[model samples]
Target: MKAVRTVAMLALCVLNADVPLNAADAAAVFPDGAKLELLWSDGEFTEGVASSPQGDIYFSDIAGKTPGRILKFDPKTKTTTVHCADSKKSNGLTFDLQGRLIACCGAAGGIQSVCEVLDSGELKPLVSEFEGKRLNAPNDLDIHPRGWIYFSDPRYGGPEPIEIDHLSVYRFDPRTGDVVRVTRDITKPNGVALSPDASTLYVAETDNGFPEVPGAGSGGGKVHMTLNAFPVDRHGNLGERRILKDFGKETGVDGLTVDSEGRIFAAVRAESRFGIGVYDSTGRELAFLKTPEVPTNCGFGRGDDGSTLYITAGKSLYRIPTESRGWFLTGQTVP
Candidate 1:
């Protein structure tokens, strides 16, 4: 009976989804006129969207002054449930090769920096402290096909003191639990994604915590938004960085994903032009899919041929149909 009710609820939610996106005419990656359907919206701010092994979706609700929580959605039941009461205010999340949920947690309140969500729903610190100091609030994270976990530690609108001097990106080896600083080149790095072939690394540079530039939007001289790509060295270090696209002062890129074909899907939070922008490997803007609000992050749903995308924007979570499967879904997650 509970399952039945859940299914019914899901049906009703779909039928009444806020900001419905019609994808019947959807074609390729950009899928012009694709519908961006609102799926859930009960949180203060949602992030950390990911598809689980069970083909379910999970997201985070960092309620600022309140205790952070993690929410999971079971597509089979078409229901949403609370997976964790205290989520350490995580921002970006993704599952590892070992099938464990890894998160760049503790964005707002004081908690673990980066942790692994255990089967018991407990939080296990993966790389919380660097050199004896708690890491700056980790904003986003991604795993390499070789099992190395790479994350960005950027302080974006949190009251926590900046423990780490520079806003940088880091890599952690799960097997040895060793961490290496990837780069601090970007003034503010918010999103980190590996290419489908795992040889290229892409980072989204956004000034979420800096003073905005005059023409660079509303803040002081803080936000220099752009998409950058770097070559992955043979020894696992990032090579020279290349500018993919620069948004000047317009909103900056937040979290981003890549499709099986190495195309980049970026969740752009540029207020006036907020939405997801799809670009090819060379950083050419191939297509633009607009979301109703400022999007934070995105992840494709389950199955090897999954074509559904789950997006986290502001206080709501939305979904839209996609024409291609995500990198992981294509069975090419790692080297």
Candidate 2:
């Protein structure tokens, strides 16, 4: 047992290196003097960070599968508190046009899928099944300006039986009340977001699986981790899979968001290069924001004119000033 544990530790250290880049990484995407400041540290695994309509920040604490909960941060107090004791272990989160908290809560229990948490503390089930069968797990999500919620359903580490034939990306249209499979080209999709113009869709192709049982998250170089982009038609359907960024042996990202100028901000999990990477639409590294731990997700703060970027990693939440606003935070409201 001791020998096995030693090997696993060594493997983890070996696999986590910087993502292979070209010879030309000369300029910085972020400001050269940029600094990341710790905002809070109160969870075992913090993730699913998002901003509310009133300017408050919301996130989830997975607590290593004991029981996940939702948390809220008030800018006025600069403090964090438990928003919902039962978050259903939701990972990635976003808000709808109605300012309602839309959560992808199907990952942990395999029971409740995507849900909308009202201000009254009521959890309304949104999408749980497709073609009369239960879902695998809904991981991350993003809301289109047209009221459609696009989410990635991938089994990371859980005891739930895989009900779906293949892990894919899905969009739930509130208007038609139907869930559309956007794309199945990915092995294990993790993060899902959109461009500012809403003309393109972004999905982080982490196609990696982490077993929820013992020895979970141990090194297994079997999964391919990459980021992909798909063109969006007028109807919100995907066009084709275009590989944007491939991490090869390095760990891919968990969540990603865009800025108003179409710049991509990815929460990279590669331990050796753990932090946030800012890239242009063409996949050119513009800047890199270093965090103290492996970042899982990020959000632009409206309080600072969208200049502040919030991050969720390990057991803490961090914030850093940026030059761009969130992709969808123009105040015109999402469509």
Candidate 3:
């Protein structure tokens, strides 16, 4: 595991400069000198990154308490393997529509569920408790073309004992194993996406006041980094909630991906602007990709590396070659 080729060059020296886009929508969303390529910086943080229906690249390397790893990056043998070395602490990695691998096992004591990564690698607990109370860690997920699995349970700092009192956005129905709690008006529901004709459901509330359950109380004060747009009917249920981008105090959006013209590729953890924003399913701001470190998730890469753009910053795994192209429920053509 040693493949790092720097050259973000301050992310192409802030390409699209200050992002008000007009140079042909900023070169049709980053193209002329797009660089950002770290590839693999070892990991202890790198969140979920998906992309595999032959174009390998599966991220997540949490390792806060030891059990977390799922690193398989091989854009044709630039090598970096160890796919699932006990990833109970996994954090979002999608691929359904039958290609399997749908995880979000948010750590704490581990196995905090919304899993299904089994081709013998283990972990197949699809919806780990909702009424019997157990989840509150399932970080990110999105896979609904009818197979519905939208997750995000938000706990963020775990030492354990949070039994899901509220902090939600879930919907797991793997055919009728049922587990719905769509969104309790999110105050802390990290990344999730599903709009490329799946209607719209882009939640990413990322409240960094972090303290919802450590001693039990305190994450109540200044909450709302915002980026919400829920309105998905046809039985997956969820309406009324349109805020779509509002990072008032800074540090919003942890992970989300939607391009296929329904644009939105946010990871933006705003330290003063720390990379990857690209919005526009009405959240405007169409292009900004500066990640030297601070991003947490982003994915797009399938047949022919789709349009390439796989990032999971800080303990690294970055890529950038976009002109936009990612909206997958498995293998393209979802209009």
> Which candidate number has the best lDDT?
3
The models' CA-based lDDT, in order, is 0.75, 0.75, 0.80
Q: List per-candidate RMSD values in Å.
A: 5.5, 7.7, 17.9
User: Which stretches of candidate 3 lie above 4 Å from their native place?
Assistant: 1-23, 32-47, 50-69, 74-76, 92-104, 107-110, 113-135, 140-162, 168-188, 192-242, 245-254, 257-264, 267-277, 280-282, 287-308, 311-335
Question: Per-residue lDDT of 118-163 in model 2, one digit per residue for the tens?
Answer: 7765567898988776777788998877778898877776666666
Off by over 4 Å in 1: 1-26, 30-33, 209-220, 329-335
Query: 249 in model 1: Cα distance from truth in Å?
Result: 0.9
Q: Find the 10 residues in a row with the least total lDDT in model 2.
A: 1-10
Question: How do the residues 197-256 of candidate 3 rate in per-residue lDDT, one tens digit apiece?
Answer: 887899988887766544323285665798989889888899999997788888888998
lDDT digits (tens) for residues 1-335 of candidate 1: 12211311111112212333333322466444456666677778898888887788888888878768888876655667788878888778899887788878865574747888887778898888777777877878888877888898766666666566666788888889888888867877889999977788899988754633222232455557889998997667999999999988787788999877788888987766677777788877666666766788998887842788788988878777777787673324444
Error of 1 at 261 (Å): 0.8
Model 3, residue pairs in steric clash: none
Which 10-residue window of candidate 1 scores lowest in summed lDDT?
7-16
Better of 1 and 3 by TM-score: 1
Please give the range of 10 consecutive residues that has the lowest summed lDDT in model 3: 1-10
TM-score per prediction, in order, is 0.86, 0.86, 0.33
Higher-ranked by lDDT: 2 or 3? 3
